[model samples]
Target chain A: MSEPTPHSMSETTSTTDDDETQRSTAADPADPAASADPTPVPGETGGKFGRYGGQYVPEALMPAIEELTDAYQRYVLENEDGFMDEFRRRLREFGGRPTPLQHAERLSERYDRDVYLKREDLLHGGAHKLNNALGQVLLAKYMGKDRVIAETGAGQHGTATAMAAAHLDMPCEVYMGERDINRQRPNVFRMTLNGATVTPVTAGRGTLKEAISETMRDWAGSVEDTHYVIGSVVGPHPFPAMVRDFQSVVSEEARRQAIETIGELPTDVVACAGGGSNTMGSFAAFLDDETVSLHAVEAGGADLSIDEEAGVAPNSASLYAGEEGVLHGARTKLLQDAHGQIVESHSVSAGLDYAGVGPELAHLVDEGRVIPVAVDDDHALEAFHLLSRTEGIIPALESAHAIAYLEAGTDTEAGTDSEAAGDDGGEPDAAADDSLGETVVVTVSGRGDKDLESVIEETAARDIDGAPDMSAFTEGI
Target chain B: MSNRAVSDRSGNSEAIAQAFADGPAYIPYLAVGDPDYESSLEYVEALERGGADLIELGLPFSEPIAEGPTIQGAVVRALEGGMTPDRFFEFVEDLDVDVPLVCMTYYNLIYQWGETEGPRPFVERAAEAGLEGFVVPDLPAEEADPLREACDEFGLDLVFIVAPTTEGDRLDRIMDRVSGYVYVQARLGTTGAQDDVSDQTAASLDRLREYDVPKAVGFGISAGDHAERIVAGGADGIIVGSALVDIVAEGVESNRSTAAVADRLEAISRELVAGAERGSRARSTGDPS
Candidate 1:
């Protein structure tokens, strides 16, 4: 009924807050409909990635978030107290830095392109999650925090965070969705072996989203003594930026190796996008490289469309078909309803079943700097067996989404409805993409040791090409 | 200090201050539609019948990170009962309660409502539906300008929380914009009932002595004893959420009738109201309680 003061579209923090006086300023009280190019000044923007990220948490958490924002600025950005230096040193010695970039001869010959694999699977916890986990746990130590909490969907992050917390000798508790705990039992055992308590979250499908909410609820009370090592780049400010900065070493090393090994930068850099930690990590250093196309492969679980009435997205392709909405603190591309309720997302791989993606990745996708593609369970399962057989590498089902895209490409003609290419039926998993260029870098985000049971059942259920004979598994592996 | 939220629409906005003017206000909260729409309306009206000075109706949000297990359960039940923002407005219209209603929820629902962006649409709908004010958990002072402006435009009060840890420049920022009341968190945690009233409640109330708004303490306040302690410690109002929700949950679990559950809620509300009044009597009569 009345015209309110038009919130300025630009970063209004510079006017309302005394920027020089303190770095612990709150979210901008002005325009949330951020402009096209959200500047990367965390201080001024309060951690917005082009209107996608900000502090959307309770006031009880404001002091804790502000303290974290201050710590992030001083330690992560400014390298205060030699935080970055020590972090890198521990990452190299403890977690194994500069994981090799191996050229895949079998995949290269099969695809007629130079396919290089960034061996993050060789890292200590067998995934890129440790990169951020170690960084956050270390940051907590510097901030005098005595305990650390993390949420996991696949147990990759949980195991990695548990390992980091154990190595740091800090008490750690991980919140795993009850369903994931039942599925990823081995990784759960590994976390327990690492001396971290795993708490099962039983709310709302018991997945990454619920686990994250549970962990945030814990942090709301225990913020003084504990640090929440958010496993992905999806949460509020400082988390997305901090986790990205920590995991960016994946791309930094890959970028250098691509130049040195290939004698030029690769034409494409591919990584699987879940909550988009690995995707953002692998794409961080390559964002300015126009020649290098960054492909973020999302899990198209069962189908691409959302069941609006049922409130279920049969896929986790937030980057591909999501609308902007807030889920876990940050406003990002999410598989939500028209009413802004976050719908349940599905994926054969627990890691990629999340409904929302990293805010920065969402911004990049909208800006045309990154490309998102979805691979269904059938194709991803085949790719898992293909990689294990061809290259002797059992890629995680989450990582297999990338390999599936590498083989089938994004042209939906090669989908389950394969009549587009006629009855002649092209290589079911080998639909070609000539634009992937001469050299391609795919990040093997994790080893698939944890996904053996799921892969066997999934591969057997669908007649996935290249799946190993299941006769021996008739009696159970 | 400026008495900004004085009311014209049946004195609804001014009713907030009046709720606390008599004595310590007994504010009880419940999800808008926990078990079902009809029963929830009965539960709220039951609170009014039981001597509730003010009421906080939770607009069920999917990701309520600020809530603990109890309130989170209530939100889930409410959402499962086909509760949406539009449905909540309709609920308010159907609800025949005289206690001033404050919508407590997250920022996304408010920001994403109606055709155009910002809080105007939701606040307009809320005001039109006879809501007095709002208590958005996620909308901090830094990100509170839009909501504040919209509330000011529609003559609804915008209340901010002052946590036990809140102080220094941040506290000043919150105090500058807060109206109707300041929700003083009794402890540093998510909202749910606790066994004992926090010792920090008195100290937090003392810290907010200079602010010129009704200071309602919430978080971990469950029993009538908590109300007494908080009110005796100089709190203007006591906000109880989880304890009442627990009764509803118990009623649903035990298969009690709507009237039975409503009767239990009314009894608890009376107990809480009496507790607060007792503390107020002690305060004014110079009793050393």
Candidate 2:
């Protein structure tokens, strides 16, 4: 069972029983052990994932957050106006849900284990971002909101939110860091084509952190008519629990598919974690299964160290090297300095270039229920090439972090995955992991179409062992 | 764990209360080390010289979500000037102003200040730095227990902002944790200068009638007339931020001397204070702005 929050923020439901959630969903008729929905029961944890989550926002946002919290309880939890039912239907018809769980035959042979790919990459808009975006946009409509706003890092969430907004005919605006807009130009084009105005955030490092702050500033002013659909499960209250509920369909379906295909739950479930929507979603249903080992891979940009004088961290591995701190509305593991100022995080993949992770994921890591691993840019790049050549699928750079973990166990030059996954506050190279077992399921979080430019540019700069011949394409293709 | 390092929390709160006891409390805010450390210190001193009551020294966090471009720009300048939490405390200690000073920043800086865990370490350090209280924009009362406990232990006051939308049970919850003066948001948005006074101010102030805390209005109180209107609408005090910082930004942009910038701030502070006093007299005489 999930632990109680250190401080519960429930005045309305404080008198209610802690065991009974304000609203509980009907159990899936399938495996009862896979129903580990940690959508913080109000009055029990409020919005906390232990000591990490709360509504750490300005007073101006309290009304909106409370309204959203109520709407979350009604529309999302109780399925009022058939909101969730409609959301699920849209996922199947519009977002292309129940994406295939393909057995990577070649990858299985290479890893000497049965490797299954939970294909979120095949979802419409080329990523798993649509699940939450579509749900939140729909929730906004149910709550009488006329407009939507969001933040994006790699532009996947931006594109997905833009697409959902267009589908629902709601005016949409997406705030993206200026650097990310320049790097992820194709995705920017996608958002604009879907009729969403893209606002470039020119603050602080011009990355996800800046974009989120900008979006929040906009929401603070326009919250009466507009809903800020947070891109990940990192923000205040209801967003984390609500987004997890929306995205948990990933693990729900993956678990059922694994049972149908391989007769039981996979021994390991791996996914790359940035703000941890996909990671939490993929692990939510498997959390109750004692035998299932969950692995969350993080981007290790260049190295694991930070430049104190420069206030810049070389990597985005918060779980690997972070202290407990509040960032982006929640207290979670963050890449910060001796002083509390958040350091700029780096990663070759724009999606994983964030200083904080999901509060729930941090709690799970602290509980020793989730294994956190880091894959440096070089290894992630190599894994990108390896997956494309071996599986004929060019994975997004974020997903390549997970793909790299598989190789870390076998790749001689690359470090072992076991050693990287250990967060015992010791040397990272001193851990052991011999229980990856037979069947492993890795969620391919997104397609690499938006990453083609980054891939070509990065591959040309480095000597990736299995990268395609780039002599003809190196001259700015 | 130790109160020896902390000044009496009531001493600062009493100072704040004493400031309010005389006339309309003129609270001015500026991010510490906006352009440079030396200039920021001068600017704060100028506020005190201009009849300021309590002062808010912004400890710039890397990400200030509640700030508009004006204050965001100020934060950017302060951060670029190498303003860390340690530097902020040092800057606070350096301020020679007589008014009780409070630190306004995000919760991250408070939660991660000291070598040990939790807000106690930060609160102890803040109390030692001669700060009276804090005005963290991001910390709502729901997540304020730890910080509240820390402030109580340190004898510092914990302030909460009550926006126009706050009401009923939620308002009660916030009011319970509020000490020092409550920051009454004059409008429904982030901190910035605006053309007209918000009509929502009267209703918000009226809702807090039952709460005995001092109501200091802020947000969009750019000019002296704005301050007058807010105080006339029944606020115990008036708080101004971005408009003053805009002058600082202009000074930095025009490459003006510190004296010139600080002189401009002092003039505006006097205007705001005079206007608030006029409103206070008008309130007693039953006149509207």
Give the alpha carbon lDDT tens digit for every residue of B14-74 in model 2: 6667777887899999999899999999999999998899999999988999999999999
TM-score of each: 0.90, 0.92
lDDT of 1 by residue, A1-477 (tens): 021111221333344221221221433232222442234442233778776788778777878888998999999988999999999999999988989999999988877678999999999989999999999999999999999999999999999999999999999999999999988999999999999999999999999999999999999899999999999998888788889889989988887787668767777888999999999899886654444667888998889899978889999999887888777888889997767778899999999989999998888776666777788888899899999999999899999999988776533443332112111111112233433666789999999999988877777677767677876775675
Report the Cα lDDT for residue B171, model 1.
91
